[model samples]
Target: MTARPLWTSHEAQDATGGALVGPDWNANGVSIDSRSVAEGDLFVALRGPNFDGHAYVADALAKGAVAALVDTLPEFPAHNPSLIKVDETLAGLRALGIARREAVGATVIGLTGSVGKTTTKEMLATAFAALGATHASPGSLNNHWGVPLSLARMPHDVRYGVFEMGMNHAGEIADLTGMVRPHVALITTVAAAHIEFFGSVEAIADAKAEIFQGVEPGGTAVLPLDNPHYARLAAAARAAGVTRHITFGETAGADFLLKGVETGPEGLTVSAVAAGLPLTFHLNFFGKHQAVNALGALAAVHAAGGDIARAAAALEGLQPLKGRGGRRKIALAGGGELTLIDESYNASPAAVAAALGVLGAETPGTGGRRIAIIGDMLELGEQSAALHADLAGPAVANKIDTVHCCGPYAAYLWELLPAAMRGLRAPDSTVLARSLARELRAGDVVMVKGSLGSRMAKVVEVITSLASDGAA
Candidate 1:
């Protein structure tokens, strides 16, 4: 085989915790999980609070990893050669990422929000791809290790890059922002997510504001005018000395204002005024919430100096992330269609409400009903039950005909809903899903949503299985 994929050995040294020994070898890519290591990959043995990757070094080498960034070398069969010692694997990874960023000089866009950050990252990356070679963080890889891994993965020749930066604690964003030093940053919105970590909503806002700390001097900040904290976020960006600021929303005075939005079976039609230009876009994703996300994309692309028309045109083909409202059509037994709205990846009060709004917009088939198959929202700490129960109001207001629930907190919501609105509730998602599948019929719009920890998406899987087996 060809020589192991090459990375600057010096680059690996700074990114990892230890010293570079041979100075001749390099790595193709950095990997924290040994299972994913491939030939020419640099395996970093990260010892987390609950797990240690050091034990897997031998397996990674056996699998053909080029080098191992480790604090302590694991005993392996004789004749293994790829070992790069490090002090702290995570620190080393961060150093390597920063070193690469300094060397590559790619245009970086930072994105943060309580919701939609991952989807927005994909949207921006898709749009950016139309203009030039681009790189974006995979999934919701916006944490301590994720940030570094994403930055490290960025191709040196990439003209544009997008990094999604997320924080569950107070100082996390500040630390990440400093490392990214983004040229253009976008805050999707501030919602009551991870509120258990902070004392109040204002504290959450303060933490999210930390994304501005990493903005390069004279760089632009993009924010949402419709968010309640819009002014506060804008002020924070300015206080951090951001030289340019842009706003996107349906609200008046936004620099990239969404004038109107119409959703159909095809997708959504967005009329907007951006950079003092009139524009209209037919985006591929569904819902008014997505139109707002598109606005965020527009602002970032424009702030990055790309054409708004081109960005809008590029959004038409963008695919939704699975479990985030990506549509799945299932044919019913009686010659009709059952549309599944998969929002089961995660949820918050704001996101739940938004998903209901999308459900409200969905046009059910003839003689079909709108059903909401929901699970509990996690991470609210003391407010978890109340938040779960409170969703009944939104469900009623949105005209949901039936509500199916699973999980402990979901039981609270089941009790809270009016008698006529309640469909089924079980101690677990399996029973709830079974009941839902039996009751579901053609022309029904079923929305599945809950925190990922609740395992709500399993119900979507069940529905899909039944649809495939001709049981629905």
Candidate 2:
């Protein structure tokens, strides 16, 4: 079946106040990056401090872009390229997004937090898709430009739309939420993720609360009852004129309360009560944190007018995203298999602790040793060293047999580890990747994790390449 045209040239011109040149065309999608531009996509030539999309206009057109939205037209080789000339491309993108939101009657849910934003967003997208045609933000498209891009990409006929909004500074989310104007605003939890910018977790909570500022009148606010900042977020929601609230977690007063969790080789079996109804489901993912994220997702689904019981059942097929908690088994060169847990996408103190707890629950293969390869946790402010050192406690509690420390901050953790538990210490992931790959044996459970800047995924790539012929 052919997909419907997302934007016609006439509609785009009306939305952005831009003049069209050469020819009229219908776009099936929108794109900003020339490298990944698809056929029938309307490529927006965005300009930034470091790079300009105008430089790639010809390339984008050659790759089958229907039209290029630009502030300044670039010279093409031989072909006449279709162009929409706006005063500024970024403003043009935002205008298209606002127009799309006004046109669609989909239930919009805006989500944000210090952590679990991406995970919870994926969960919501998965659960909501089971009930209706749902459009969600791809990856971590929750920033200034990412929000508008995701919004503009939303289809006109979608029954539900979920957008993930993120921030490092205080006012970032407020600006985004104003553009989103969601019917349900969800704050996953408040933690010390970007404490370098905010100075304190309370300030982070206040910033996350900004999601409530743009909630449509009579909309709902879904919050985490387990977080210490719950009261602060709830108060801010009420102040923002959002009176309806749905709380989820293990706390006694939570509307979506978790009763118990049992872990098995397959995944986790969760028992909970949502809206006074008993519900039990299985999640093919690790950690108690994931179970909590599931509760929040189900609550948001119910708040958005979907059946909570059916959404809970949809969670049974949920799997961890790559670089999050994804697990893989690699066939070693000689004889056995090695289990690799990839947590290398990004990390904070709280996130690292949760990963460690998941590792603790795993029963390694016969004669297998539990190992952790850790890199630096960034944006921790002045407490960076202490926060890194604090991880040694979780490592010990989990009874990990070996610890490989990478990067300068991880050195603090290396110093605190018991001599018997120490494995390898390197200045960075590049240096650690070589030695760490050789040290692994068939019966080993290895977990790699760090912040994005730490480049820990490189280590995961190297270990994955060790698979023998015909190995999965």
Candidate 3:
């Protein structure tokens, strides 16, 4: 129901047979992944770096796909609707999204950063939903095909749009934002993620600042003031001729300033002043990063001309993304419980620090241990070892009672920890996870974190599996 073709013949003419399909034979939606393709959806068979979606064309068709967009058409069932062969399916999808955005006059908000983009996008979407009809990217579907797919899926009657832009390299954000042509652009904060690719933190800032480049002239720019490179991004926003600028963070200059933060059993309680209005609210998500995400959401909602208090109230039901700092209550073997903070989706130094800060504030069940099970932080380039070693301070500051780590990088932190804190360390996750499973107590507040490549979620799985089996 989210996507409808703007032109049936435009796609048909671009098809191999050229304008053979009727003008009324247009699709109701578009999808790149076959599993998510709904009935009457146009299936785009994109060739990704890993799997080729072309192999799933038959699957899509069988599931009621109206048409197929592909580089090469495969043999289909006799009753199949139509196959549109193009130079590149990915390119075709992009073109359709670009055309759709131009035709529809919806205001688009583009968001990008080293961390928190997805969470912040979700925040913005929830806040906007409280105001009017809203459309947003699902999960971390903020990449190349994901961005266009999100744009193409925009409902015709949506009053506002939020698009999360992401990249692991330079120029990717620029290309994505240009396609989105967002009227409001926000950089959550420039962090040292993908440092391996950019070679320095400044390059990361420059890449994140690319979000401002695609903002329409006289558009608003929302930014963070807590980051050291805030001035650089501020300069970039000014240079882009952004008509309105909004800053969010704990800084005094921030238009929306964090007056107070209270983390608790339910969720995060936040107090802030935005546009000279004092606002107090609670967010459904956990972590200090949620506060930052809320600020970004506030800035976005204010830019969209919504009532900030109403938007703030909407945050109460905003749930966190799975594998992205959401809390899950786990029953222990001894008839008690503890909360699991699943930050297993990805990791970086900045993200780890932020997560630790959240852990530092959480109050677990009576006499419970504050535990951290962390894996490698990948793609640090030359700073990998030192960065790993640097986590000990955060662990101590966060009052983590026990530290169980895996991977070569985590070993650095394991050795650097004081004699009492390090409970387990393994070259790989399997052995370390097995040991960690044995150490869970009835009242332990455990946080699991690691990069995607580190597969640290396996530890969370192992712990949950044991708990499910009543072993811990």
Pick by lDDT: which candidate is best?
A: 2
Q: Lowest summed-lDDT stretch of 10 residues in model 1?
A: 15-24
Instruction: Tell me which residue pairs clash in candidate 2.
Output: none
Candidate maximizing TM-score: 2
The alpha-carbon deviation from the true structure for residue 20 of candidate 1, after best TM-score superposition, in angstroms, is 3.9
> Model 1 residue 41 lDDT?
80
What does candidate 2's lDDT look like per residue over 1-472, in tens digits? 9777899999999999999988999998999999999999999999999999999988899999999999997877688889999999999999999899989999999999888999999999999999999999999999989999998999989999999999999999999999899999999989989999988999999999999999999999999999999999999999999999999999998999999999987889999999889999999888999999999999999899899888888888778898999998999877799899999999999999999888887878888989999999999989899999999999999998999999999999999999999999999999999897678988899999999999999999889988886445
Q: lDDT by residue for model 3 over 39-71, one digit each (tens)?
A: 888888999789999999889978988777778
lDDT-better candidate, 1 vs 2: 2
Local distance difference test, each candidate = 0.84, 0.93, 0.83
> lDDT rank, highest first?
2, 1, 3
Q: Which stretches of candidate 1 lie over 4 Å from their true place?
A: 1-6, 14-17, 21-24, 333-335, 468-472
All candidates: TM-score? 0.95, 0.98, 0.94
**Model 2 residue-pair collision total:** 0
The residue ranges of model 2 lying beyond 4 angstroms of the native Cα positions read: 1-3
How big is the positional error of residue 3 in model 2, measured in Å on the Cα after superposition?
A: 5.8
lDDT of 2 at 86: 98
